[model samples]
Target: ASFSHSQYEATISWPQIVAALANNLYLGPQLGIDEDSGYPIFNADPGRLFTPLTRAEYDSIAQRTVYHPQSQSDTLAFTFSNLDLFQLPAGAAGFAGVVEYGYQSYDLKPDPLATQYYYYSWKDSDGSGSRNRWAAAGELRMPLLDSLSLSVAGRYDDYRFAGNSADKFTYSAGIEWRPLESLLVRSSYGTAFRAPDLHYVYSGVGNDETGGTDYYRCRTEEPDEDLTDCSYSDEGLIRTRSGNRALGPETSTSWTAGFVFSPRENFDVSIDYFNIDMRNQVQDLSTDRLLQLEANCRIGSDVNGNPVDVSSPSCIDAIARINRLANGNLYGITVNPVNVARERTSGVDLSAHYRLATGIGDFRFSGNYTWTREHLFQQYTGDADVDEFQVNSGFDIPRNKASASVSWEKNAWTVTLHGDRLGRLPNSDSYDQIVDTEAGEEAWIGATYRYNLSTEYRFNERMRLSFAVTNLFDKMPPKDPSYPSSPYYDGSWFDSMGRSYYVQLTTRFGGGPL
Candidate 1:
């Protein structure tokens, strides 16, 4: 029931230096609806509709019914990459160094009311820009010895949120060692910070079509005044960004260690473990968190019923949904992500491959398996709802995820297959619930085949033709509605390609070689 539309214009201003650097600017107007095609015909609430919304009425609602973007934006960007080799000492473990950098800025024309679905009522009284970010980074690799290698990289970025901004600094380091011809080991540790994207930190957008969440009352104690969305149980009655600013970027400290073992030229096995702990994780009160907030902002009472308002309304609903973590917050002060004490994560990956030669042809295959475990560490409610939640209020992180593929190539023909699996996500947003995302992922397989047909016609030349069929089986991906939670998944490849075909023909430039 969701739809989106975008109109774009791109201008490239590259000169003969084009071979060295390519630069361009993209301008476009975009708008989209990320919700279902209106409300469910059978699920509409009759109480709120003074007049009930009939099935016909619901069906009449249009999907992606947003206005064309009247405000335009331009992303000015370009990349310049080139490498030159410089050998170390003559017979020394030969090594070369490389350096590259890229920069881009997303600028949008001023449009205060730029929003999705033309959702504007006199009630919505704010305007902001389309979100964008700018970044620059560089990296270098060096062979320190015949059996050792090292690499270093760094990046600095600035995220623009309307008139405000946030800065980011990231770095990475790695080294490899080969103690013997057949035994190799490598390890690395680095830190990186992820800036909040447009989807979350900027372009503030909210919907209350459903009364699943509650709001805070930072400025009001009265019942009839314009309290600025402090409602506990009303839909479309509260808002969080009415006077709010964008949030800051989150930071992460990460490290990885792994080794590769190649017993034979045709077979190899490897394993890697990674751990990352993010601080000031940039999570906010989405519908799900808002629901949790109700519980957070609630008021606990004693046997005499002494009234004590809870931190906020989010806690009440969240505790309820999560299988009851008790009626009130044991922690007296309201807890929030920004105010959030901290967040951490850890995981491991295992991948292997084997190849064999047979009279009929050649056979080879590979695969990777992963395991993950996450913790909100700072806040583990003894009474928290673990089974019903996929994400904690402070983070949207999966402890583990893995994907694998197996394939064989024989002459001109080849067959391949791949599959990815995701474990149960923790503390998911309510959107996850509405979309039914607990289902995880479906196993999918795709195969492509290429054939070469050539016939000799000259002394030493022949015409050759090649053709390929992609997604030959057309196996549609699992619709389990859980797992990856992506909007695109019909037949795999994530909107890139479906079952399709292609062909091409070629001959020697001088038509003299076979």
Candidate 2:
């Protein structure tokens, strides 16, 4: 059995706690666990495992303890996962359950990214906000109709935000049927949701700072406790913390229908169509939309043909910062949101596999492909550009992406090959949604290979491993300088982490069972 337990309390200023207990804050020699709060505090910077702290010891962070360091945005998130089973009754199905709980409490911060200088000093009471969620679910599998199997799962979550709480329900049902020796059909449907994160609702102005300009944000929304009145702005866009007390959870409904065909052990194929529709999608107001709303809110010509104001500039500016309203035309280019809208996402998953045994002794190979077409079914109508992928033509989708892998295994040796092939699809930016046409990037292929040998004897297990490379064919990412540049985004999307290779050894201890 595996079990875990955690005890955490919200401390408004954890940085101060670290400062107060650099070496040993509690238990007379042990660090952290203040006399009253009894919580752990870190004073040192935890250097990256992959990226070591490049700079030499600096006076500013000298007191930071390597073992324990304070996070800019403090959080106490707990995760617990475990699985145990009751042997199924030989001819009867059995049951199992899973449970999880998470909690986080953070302090208020102001002008986080330096995006805006000093608007309303983001303020909060010590430990004024917290989040707690619990999920419990059970599953039961019952054999049916000789070659058919059925399973049902149900789950529920209880959430608390800013002292207020609510409940959410989700469930799933699935059925697998084999009508013939070579064919099988499967179907399932479920409900899903996304709760506003402490980061999204309460962590006001964060890394919203952009270099060339005053602000850099994922969405064009002003930072504030209320999300309705902000806009994404450059000159005046200031960073303020976000904290919404009454926001509800975003919701969605989804389903999948698929079929499989396997005539022989060497060949198997499957196709699945999946759909997901979400309501009240949590997204930032785009600078473009904010500007339109500020100047004129003409969503898509009204039912009756007439010029309509896209958004209210005055209304958008009042919620977050006062400094951003300086320019009249600025609102045309800026965006922010205190009361943003909702969005939707839907797509399909397609795949097939073929395996073969060759002269290489028990050679094994396989491949899979997926096609997803998404769209924006947001609260507002000006989502034309938002739904870029021409996928469904609705804005929130991406051209489909596919991936496949093949491998061979015999005795103690295993060799595998794989690659990701992005379809030459359209982009969110240009008149030509086709990736190959736009300068953003073109669909390219990347492949890799791994060879490993393993043998076990006595109480010891070991293996030798080597890797071929990424983009096996030296398939470089697409780069077209002709693509235009925008003040907010340059077309310099990161190329794939170029091809790479490595080798290593693996070891394992002998187990009690044989």
Candidate 3:
């Protein structure tokens, strides 16, 4: 029923500097070398660093690259609904069945330069592949009594790609009970599956970089200097990553129980509890953690000077994946994705909405909040569970989060305000060295909030104008001195942009009243 095609192209250019040659020419005079009589220099050779006399000479060293990639997909689907399965005491049992087929292909071509390394340029590898998929699903719903109903569904999916294939079957069931007109209860259990991402399985070798203070090296080489004052932060070491075609599909089982309360037609609230158990989760070591593990492998201690077992599998793997210079400086690292043991989490969700009509205008209020009770993970079957819900757990996910909004509407105008609260989290992912000196306690970034406001006006049945402001108060991200990386804040959760504004005008050519 649908088909899509996409194409992308990019051109990149950069300057490649010969650091040694430049340094030698600039420092010639300091080293007592006078290759050029009147030229300024400060310690090395001039013949080895002569400037290019023509554009052609300079072009030979300048790096340039072109990359193009394309992809296409097609799908056809059919569904049959409202078919009667059987008769029940209160209603007729209805069934629905669906069938679908899809095919997709992508050509991910990297530039020729991507295979070669430059003094300051990154490297990348090819990722080109295609896949086809087929799926079938069915659902049945039955009403046994006037106030209770039940539903069940099942699905099967098969995928084929690059000399490999995977197939899975999943199912779900749910029950609902409405003892009163204003109250309802529901519960559900389900099993789910996900195929490996195309890029995760098809991407070849790639290289990138990250920068931070090499704490282990600094501590060993400059034992007299305070760690906070160490001046080792510089250009990042090289890191290489690659994909794996042997990755298996991820599977999970989830259960949920919830209830809805509606005391009046204009007000409602719902609360739900959910738990999930996942297996064969695919992942790779984060840059921060990788660096931390590298440090641990060499020093056998955390930032706090606590002892660590350097002979463990994690440390052994870390040592094997990294290469070091003769002076013990980091040279390169290899990080490949792999399937891990398990991840289990449980949480509660609460939401409510209310609407009121008054002489001034119609007002609506809505709010939602989530609380994570527990989060546990294991890297291997026999490994100990790592608790991830506590403070300073080295995970970005917060234990609590909430949002609220209010809106007002009149004859031709509407206005709304919204706010979000990002819960507290550790400033650094490492296990130690975060403290408030005066208070003698660990320091953390407390809850932060942002707000937005918008207003809209309708000029006619088909035209409207709108304006909005995000981060209305221009709140800045919290600063943490203990963070190891540059721009010492969690960029993943917060935006550095202080404030933003926008305006828009919309018009409809053929539609109902606005």
Evaluated with lDDT, which candidate comes out highest?
A: 3
As for lDDT, the candidate ahead, 1 or 3, is 3
The segments of candidate 3 whose C-alpha lies over 4 angstroms from its true place after superposition are: 1-73, 105-115, 119-121, 212-236, 294-316, 390-393, 410-415, 433-442, 452-476, 495-514
Ranking by TM-score: 3, 2, 1
**Candidate 3 residue-pair clash tally:** 7
Q: Per-residue CA lDDT of candidate 3, range 89-187, in tens?
A: 988999998889888776676566665664334677778777899999999999988999999999999998768888999999999999999999999
- Which has the better TM-score: candidate 1, or candidate 3? 3
The runs of at least 3 residues in candidate 1 whose Cα sits more than 4 Å from the true structure, single-residue gaps closed, are 1-137, 158-161, 204-206, 211-245, 296-341, 358-361, 377-400, 410-413, 424-514
lDDT of 2: 0.47
Q: Give the TM-score of candidate 1.
A: 0.53
Worst 10 residues of 1 by lDDT: 18-27
Estimate, for each residue in 1-514, the C-alpha lDDT of model 1 and write its tens digit.
1122334444322111111111110111223344666422233234544656565544333122222223344445444433434555422232232222222233222223323223322112223345456667666677777888877777777765657777777888888899887767888877777655443433333322223333232212333432223343333333333223555667778888888999899988998887877665654434435444443344353112334345323344344432211542121111122312356666688888888888876776777777765554432223232222242232343445566655555555555555555543332222222223355332221222222222212222455555555555554443433322334232222344456766666567653565
Number of clashes found in candidate 2:
52
Alpha-carbon error at 369 in model 3, in Å? 0.6
Q: How do the residues 1-514 of candidate 2 rate in per-residue lDDT, one tens digit apiece? A: 2234444433232221122232332223445567676676555434322343333412322331111112222223333323323333334565667676666555443213222322122222111356777777777776656678777888788888766776878888899999998999999988876677664565433323221121222122332311122242223332323445566677778888889999886788888888876666656544433333232232322212335443534333422332343442222132223333545555667667776666765655555666666654434434322454543121332356666676676655666667666555332233212343464453222222322222222322343444455555554455433222232222233255555665555554554432
Model 1, residue 119: displacement in angstroms?
8.4
